[model samples]
Target chain A: MKLVVHMGVLLGVGLGLGLADMALRPLAESAENATDINDLIGQTDPDSGTPANTEPDVDTPEIRDPVDDGTGNTEPVDDGTSDNTEPVVDTPPDVPVVTSEPEFPRTTPGPNWPAHHVTVEQASQLFGRPDVLFVDARALDKFEEGHVQGAICLPLEAFHGQQPQILEFHTSMDFPIVVIYCGGGDCEESDAVRDLLMPDGYENVYVMHDGWPGWVKMGLPGETGQGEFEGFYDW
Target chain B: MGDKDSCSAGCGMTRWIALPVRVALGGVFVFAAFNKLFITNGPALFNKSIHAFKLDEYGMTEGMMTLSTHLVPWVELVAGLALILGFWLRAAATITGAMLVVFIAMYASVLLRDLNVECGCFGKLSPFCPKTVGSCHILQNATMLLMAGLLAWWGRSAISVDGMLAGKAKAPADAA
Candidate 1:
């Protein structure tokens, strides 16, 4: 009878303490903000039947500069600013004018295309690089089904809870680049993950523009099941 | 008189031997609770760890997961303190022993399913076991279970709160 009383007291105390802790430390706002996975997956582009890039193209130059008509008249054009005292001049004979676009296309700030979004081709180039880390933002079941050869799974819904682990792994590896991807076609999970990671001092986080489907479609290295922690401690 | 003396001597020896075992078991539980409850974002990390076991696949709801996440470490804390103070050694040992059994079973399930999940036994401070679940966890928990069983069977030592209280209770009975 004494043993039973002791057990009951311990249980009651534990329950009280647990409830107090829960009440004190509320769940993070991220949990409340997490979008339903089904809702995200069901969304599609009506026009192209692809993931709609509804977010405004912040990468595009909004204001175009007036082109110089090449009159070579040494006159300061009345640019709106009083600080513009010097006249615009053509390039000197010694200087060369290079007019080539960058090797890879840049993405605009949007749900489908994060500012640092990398194309499937670019991601392929960085695949074997030691400085790059791949993170799969898909659900665990999807990740277990198949994922990028060395990607770690960190689903969007679980990001708030699981971020410490990801941060620890990333910091330990000191990977310069982190490329996150989710299901292809209308999936913003990857972008959502990138947004969450940015505030944590990760400036080099990138999202794979075409996501998992694009990687598989390209016949890139993909594997099923979770990969063992390759270089770092298994934790 | 000789037989009585010998039995008393045996009981004294048992209590002395059980002291360290009780303390060690209590200390481990306290440390485990500290890691799970006091570390930065500890509860959240623990919640994730529990989810990795995929209890939802067995029909566990999100609410149940959250409740367990909150409840477990506190229970560890209470039971560990009780054992360490020797206020209720048998009861504390019983609770901790039961917990160890559940832990061993969980580890076994993980291995059987071939699931690649972190043990999360000590949060970010796993010293004895590796990060991943394996046979070693079972061994470690089994060892703790033995310690708990010993405490439950042996009861309290003379150098304990329970011992003092028992002595005080017996004094009045002897006078009567």
Candidate 2:
């Protein structure tokens, strides 16, 4: 009976203190206005000469006049001269304006997506910028095998153990634009890492929707090796 | 009365041995709880650590996670203090033993699933085991479980609060 009473008391005290702590803590920041993608969309980098937003140009079909050769045969022909061709529809079928953007289809977030979801093109634009910091949220093996050129590996599972390293890196910057990525399809590691960082006052975090596979597929710069702080072996 | 007599009889040597074990176990718990509760953004970071276990896939909701985030360190704190002060050694040992069992099970699960997760056992300070989950963590928790078991089996120790209280309660009965 005394053992039961002691157990009850300990549990009751723990629960009471827990409730009090929860009530005292401030509510987490909401997803409203969390994404800064809109602000980033139209901005152009002067040095790179690449426009941040590369929404594909809509193709206009060429309108050719039918020519009659007096044999009652009307044929639409290429005139080989610019006189009959519409100037606006002169883009060659073989060459596209935005060659940097890959043709492969990539997953995109829905309308109500909370995190700042960036496509591979946008991520490529942000890449190598002094203000941007890429974080890989995959396991250590995957990160060491291949990852974005300068991305630091902060696997979602190891975040707590690496908190000091993370804080030191974050504080070393003046609020850098952090982009976190994981394995492309259906991986939530990037979002999970972002969530962990956000509560610690990292506001500029974004998720690469298509992830590392997309980056690699687009022929973006990447490197293979262990990251600086990912010294703990997964095995 | 019976408990005090047993402590004074053949169990005298065992009580002395259990003292250091109880104190050491309590100290470890206290230190761990301190790291989890007092560090900067400790709770939030600990929450992320818990999420890494992917308990959501096991049907644990966000609400349950939040509750655990708040409850675990506090329990550790209270139980640890109780053990050190020897106010309720049996109860404290029972609580910590139960927790160690859970931790060993969690480590085993993580290993079996081949999930590459770091052990958030000591937050950012992993003194005993490697940060990543491995057999070392299971061994460490198992050792702690043994210490807790020893403390629980040998209820009260010499020079303890429980001993003092028991003596005081017995004094009036002797006068009667």
Candidate 3:
């Protein structure tokens, strides 16, 4: 009967699975063992300061998705100020939303919005141009922690309940080109700002993928805290 | 010697396969949904796995992903409940057969793409990713496919309402 044939097939499949699992079990065990032992593969060398007994950080560094849509990303974000001083980027507890890299084939790729995310060199040109206006999308506090020099810090949250405020900020609409960058290539803060600005008729908004980290990695100028950058930090 | 008409439609034969098929596939859904409801970070982990694949790069939207979160569980729950009670056996079998076909296709595509990603299916046994391209998930679905096909082929035989209804219909003939 057909039912009998089906059982027969399922049985064959089960046996094959069992055999495969048995053959692979030892290899699987060894692989896990190696991963457990080698997680700190580089850290334990005598000169390396990593504590040998300490477990490696559970948070794996985000790797580039192999199927990258060509936009560069996964930057170590910082307030524009981190020098050689702070090497490890700590996971900030308060901010739950990480910036998203601008996905291409963007549902609506319109201009007068944050340009499709660009690389370091592309961002540098925009930042260096006198006609360009950069908006830092991190919160005021985060901006204080680090921010690009000459960029205005206008936290995206400002548009939370108030649509009017975003318009007021963009009152100068046409002249200087507006670009927003949040936490570098890994974040999407810049994109949201662009979307908001687009509908508000701000005409031109851009998200810098090589955002905070992009600027930092290139050794560009930035300041920390409510210092000389004060006026621009809250824009 | 040949009552060809009864066998031609296959109504009698299909009923036989439905019982086991419903139970097995329904069990998978029941198991899947129960864990989804109970696990502390089930949705997050599953969503993370989805992102981990960069499916968005392939045009899967956030809305689509969110839709799956709710839709998958509901289908599993409803199908499972009906399957357990042997209620609506025909509808359950047909839908389940369709879903399994989709699963097989997805697995095939993953294999074709050589994507080494967790399938995020059975959530509990699904390995923490950076998983290898070669996966057993395709085989798992193939088995489910057979079950679905078998059930669809035999609508009522094992332990189903279809059989009960057929039996009731035949009772009058026996009485005569």
Candidate 4:
């Protein structure tokens, strides 16, 4: 009976400590945040402490002028308030937004194409389409290095969390097609990406059954995700 | 008192060491039951449990889930307390051994099936994450299985109630 009582006490202590440990986590992290900034740099709490980080704005950071002598240390000598500010002479004209209609080939099984896997030739034609929204659902780092031409990087994991902004990016397009694809055959992330835009009543959502390795192996026109936004033909 | 008393003292020391390990192992099963009870895909865990125990022929229904989870935690907690307290040591060791075999076989089936499901041992928290199809960090489980084998093979230490009572009874008989 004595032994049984001791065992019961041990069990109670273990469970009590476990619950108490969870309740103390926030308290511990907040206590850490009150320390030196450099020591507190990498401390991360999934749902807390981020907003209070704004309190570290004690030192005002320098904002530079639009044009400067190549040296970054140069002060804003082009201050507009100068008596010789000279009425803003040699000002550049506002450039008009280009609305060029680039012709692109369309795909077979055009919209709401379910489980009908596309071949390389079919994908190549789809890639050339004007309306197809190709998404590289890889890690951000992997997507940044290379992607299909006219493709955008919205990794499947990150896409789910930021769905509102993602939906708005293509809100104006009519019957827009999004071809989501991931790394390879083993990765089911392409299918996992039934994210906000798909069910938000946008028309077409097709998964590239095979992925980037497949796209590149077929010698299709491809571009790196890393470079400049404009002039991506030979990228 | 000549030979057996000396043996009993030696055995008692080992029982003290074995007690903590048994409690730890039993606690793992208790935690497993707690998760499978409340947080798991409940019907799914029952279906898997039936399959793991090779009870698939009975056609597992939703009704059995409450029974399985309830029985399992109590069994684990009782066995844990008994083993740690050196009460009914042989029975506790035997049951712990059996439980470990069940865990090993369950994970092995998961290995063969290539199911893309986390082993819901701890349910929502720290689910058994498989790195690939049909395999996990298999070595960690293999080590636990080895510990179970050790406990089963050498659980005859005499610090238990069985030894204390048996020794005194034998002493009066010898004095007679």
Please name the candidate that would achieve the greatest TM-score relative to the true structure: 2
Q: Rank the candidates by lDDT, best first.
A: 2, 1, 3, 4
Q: Write the per-residue lDDT of candidate 2 for residues A189-217, one digit (tens) a residue.
A: 88888877764546678887667766765
Report, in order, each candidate's fnat: 0.48, 0.38, 0.00, 0.00
lDDT of 1 by residue, A104-163 (tens): 122212233434665555566667778678998888778777788988887786655565
lDDT of 3 by residue, A14-85 (tens): 345434533554222321221211121233424433223232123323333323545444343322221122
The CAPRI classification for model 1 reads as: acceptable
Q: For model 1, give the TM-score of chain B.
A: 0.91
Clashing pairs in 2: none
C-alpha DockQ for predicted model 4: 0.03
Better of 1 and 4 by DockQ: 1
Q: In candidate 4 chain B, where is summed lDDT lowest over 10 consecutive residues?
A: B38-47
Higher-ranked by lDDT: 1 or 4: 1
Comparison by TM-score, 1 against 4, better one: 1
| A37: Cα error in model 1, Å | 26
C-alpha lDDT (0 to 100) for residue A49 of candidate 3:
33
TM-score of each: 0.55, 0.56, 0.39, 0.35
lDDT, model 1, position A31: 25
**Number of colliding residue pairs in each model:** 0, 0, 20, 0
User: Candidate 4: what is its chain A TM-score?
Assistant: 0.44
